[model samples]
Target chain A: EADIYQTPRYLVIGTGKKITLECSQTMGHDKMYWYQQDPGMELHLIHYSYGVNSTEKGDLSSESTVSRIRTEHFPLTLESARPSHTSQYLCASSGYRNEKLFFGSGTQLSVL
Target chain B: AQTVTQSQPEMSVQEAETVTLSCTYDTSESDYYLFWYKQPPSRQMILVIRQEAYKQQNATENRFSVNFQKAAKSFSLKISDSQLGDAAMYFCAYRSAIRNSNYQLIWGAGTKLIIKP
Candidate 1:
């Protein structure tokens, strides 16, 4: 089984509320990424990190922000939730030399 | 620019049968990587198989095998003796092997595979 984990498997909150999705990996990989997926559609890259203290926006523009203070932890925070932000967030990690990505179970966020 | 395409949005197959999922990609780079990833309902995405562009031989993992046609730019997945557990969204992804590239996977719109019992 993959060591990557995402907390709050499912979340539903009212609009304007602040929320944070947690992602952690025991693999000690330097490259981490967060993708936004809508149901069975294609994945949209939102944020990624090369290592601790390095974060970059992905191909898609997202309102959520991510912080990689530690190698094992990468958390995404939304200042104000909106219905548009209601989508599944998936976290993944990979070593610098390995191109394979290990993904988390994903967190399904719903904004009411 | 590189792009992956899964023309079949959805496909179905009887359990214990074989099924092929089609995937095609376009890229100017000669060397790259092609991957097949499976995501079950609410489950984490997992790598099914991988094929390096430079290799002439196809890659296979257990019942999962890929038909890699470099000249045609086609990488189709063949699942033998399909099981109900194989039902999931199958995605085709491509990554550039060039140095300095972000190594981000260019994904195709996934194809939902339904295994009928």
Candidate 2:
């Protein structure tokens, strides 16, 4: 199993509340990614980081933002939670492009 | 840009039978990688298999194998002697080999496989 961990396995919050999803890995991986998925929907890349201080927006336009201040930590934050933002957020780390990705259990968010 | 597609949103097979999940991709880069990931009800993305586009030979891991047709842009996962444990949502992914890109994986809509006892 990967050393990656995500906080708040399940979360339910009211609309307009700010929330942050925490993801950390002890594997010292340079590549980290965050994907958003709804029930029976395709996984959409929302944010990614190659290394410390490097972040990029993914294919799907996400209002949330991410920061990579350290190699092991990549957190995603939503400024104003909306009902549409309710989905499963997955965090993954990879040591190399050819290597397999280690994914966290994922955070199931619900905005009411 | 690269895109992966899993046309079969759902599939089923009897226990101990063989089942295949289809995947196709579109890319301009000649060098890249393809992968199959399994997400069980537990919601953990597990690596099932991988295939390097540069290699002509298919990749196999015990009960899992890939039928990769490079020319046809087809990469399918075949689970031999399917087991109940194989039931899950399977995703096909593609990664570019370009130097500038950070090896971002393009994912497909998952195919949920049901194993009947």
Report the number of the highest-TM-score candidate: 1
Computed on C-alpha atoms, the DockQ of candidate 2 is 0.73
Interface RMSD of each: 0.9, 1.4
DockQ of each: 0.86, 0.73
Tens digits of per-residue lDDT for model 1, B1-117: 999999999999999999999999999999999999999997889999999999999999999999999999999999999999999999999999999888899999999999999
Model 1, C-alpha of B42: deviation from truth (Å): 1.6
lDDT tens digits by residue: candidate 2, B1-117: 788999999999999999999999999889999999999996688899999999999999999999999999999999999999999999999988778877778899999999999
- Docking class for candidate 1: high
Worst 10 residues of 2 chain A by lDDT: A92-101
Instruction: Residues A2-103, candidate 1: write the lDDT tens digits.
Output: 999999999999999999999999998999999999998999999999999999999999999999999999999999999999999999999975579999
- In angstroms, how far off is B53's CA in candidate 1? 0.3
